[model samples]
Target chain A: EPEVTQTPSHQVTQMGQEVILRCVPISNHLYFYWYRQILGQKVEFLVSFYNNEISEKSEIFDDQFSVERPDGSNFTLKIRSTKLEDSAMYFCASNLRQGGNQPQHFGDGTRLSIL
Target chain B: AQTVTQSQPEMSVQEAETVTLSCTYDTSESDYYLFWYKQPPSRQMILVIRQEAYKQQNATENRFSVNFQKAAKSFSLKISDSQLGDAAMYFCAYRRSAGNTGKLIFGQGTTLQVKP
Candidate 1:
């Protein structure tokens, strides 16, 4: 089955440095999202993208965070400056359509480690 | 704001037995969606099953099923004929039906251990 694919299964970055997490959603999917799970914490929604623009975002998705669909197939999340608390597992998900009943398929996830 | 809670942090079930994982959520919307996702040690979030608020019939997928109570804001997952591979972290999630940004609010998660 077609699936969302994320690059760099694991990443290590120093505090105050920038990091970019990339994802290639299913070809036919139009809606994309980014969520993060801190160790031993709930998975929290960070941002959602559609039509090549941000549709919505959470408080956790502050100015430090940005998402882009540079190419038709590539969606990326960039953190301007990493912090220790930014360490977490980042997930990329996508759906064919935007609706409550539509299930969003998720990628394996990228583990981000900030030192 | 919406919230999902999985009271049981960990549960163990013998092979070939049935196990139920509890999930409760708080949502004001009349119509929404509930989902159960399994994350194995590989850390891949896999959709196990999904239930729509408007659908009274419970949703089931193969050995995995969900009991959804809309009025009570509860959705529980039941796994039958469990196997060793069934062990994983289960997460219950919620999303609004209308004006949805495609963002899912997930529960803390429940760890399941299948014993042989």
Candidate 2:
């Protein structure tokens, strides 16, 4: 099966610095999403993008967080002025279409360790 | 608001045995979907099985199956003939069927330890 791929499986960034996590969703997928799992915590949704704009976002997705489809294939999440609490495993997911019945495939995830 | 709960923090099964992981959710919307995702040591969330609330019949994939009780808001995953590869952290998730945002609400997760 075609899978979503993420770059820099492990990222270590200093506090107050900007870090970008990148993902290449499945080629034909139309919906893309970002989620993060803190150590020993549940996975939480960050944001969803479709038609080149954000469709929905969670409260955790604050002003410091932003997502963009910089090119045709890459989906990126940029965090400005990272905090220690930002250290978590970030996962990118994609679905073929809009229906929630369609399962979203997830990438291997990028482990962001903020110092 | 929707919340998924995995009460059991951990479970264990012997090789060739069967084990069931429990999950429950609180939601007012009747039309929705439930899922089981497995994340091994590698940390990739892999979809194990899915159940649609509208469907009365439970969904089964190979040795994996789900017991979905829409009225009780319960969805559980059963893994049969468990193997070493089955050892992973299992998460139960929920999603609303109505919206275009297919964001998944995940449970805290249950770690499955399989012993040979």
Candidate 3:
């Protein structure tokens, strides 16, 4: 089965530095999303992207966070300035449709560690 | 705001027995979708089952089934004849059915341990 793939399984960065998490969603899937899970916390939605634009975002997705589908297959999430609290498992997900009704497939995720 | 709650932090069942994981959600929307996802030790989120809020009948997938009570805002997952492979973290998720961007709100998750 075709699955979502993410790059740099683990990342270690310092506070105030920038980080970019990359994902290549399942081929032929349309909608894409970024979500994070703090240690011992629930998975939180950050933003959703479709048609190369942000369709929706949560409060956690502040100005420091940005998502881009630079090419047909690669979707990326960039945090301009990382904070200690920003360290978490960042997941990339995608679905075939734009609506939330479809089941979203998630990648293994990129673990970000900020010191 | 939409929130999913998994009251049971942990649960265990003997192999070949059955187990049920409880999940409750708070949502104002009339039409939505509910999902159960399982994360094994490998840490891959796999879709176990799904239920559409508008449907009254529960959804079943082999040994896995869901009891979706729309009125009570409850969506519980039942695992029948549980196996050791079923030991994993299960998360309940909710999403609005109408929107183009289907962002899922996930529960804290229930850690299931299947004893052999």
Q: What are the per-residue Cα lDDT tens digits for candidate 2 across B33-116? A: 999999999988999999999999999999999999999999999999999999999999999998649899999999999999
Error of 1 at B44 (Å): 1.0
**Candidate 2 ranges with C-alpha deviation above 4 Å:** none
**Residue pairs in collision within model 2:** none
The DockQ values of the predictions, listed in order, are 0.88, 0.84, 0.77
Backbone clash numbers for all candidates listed: 0, 0, 2
* Cα TM-score per model: 0.98, 0.98, 0.97
DockQ, 0 to 1 scale, candidate 3: 0.77
Scoring only the second chain, what is candidate 3's TM-score?
Answer: 0.98
Q: What's the ranking of the predictions by DockQ, best on top?
A: 1, 2, 3
- Per residue, candidate 1 scores C-alpha lDDT tens digits across B20-44 of 9999999888888999999999998
Using lDDT, rank the candidates from best to worst.
Answer: 2, 1, 3
Q: lDDT tens digits, residues A12-85, model 1? A: 99999999999999999999999999999999999999998999999999999999999799999999999999
Candidates 1 and 3 compared by DockQ, better number: 1
User: For model 2, what TM-score does chain A reach?
Assistant: 0.98
lDDT of each: 0.94, 0.95, 0.94
lDDT score for residue B70 of model 2: 90
In model 1, what is the error at residue A76, expressed in angstroms? 0.4
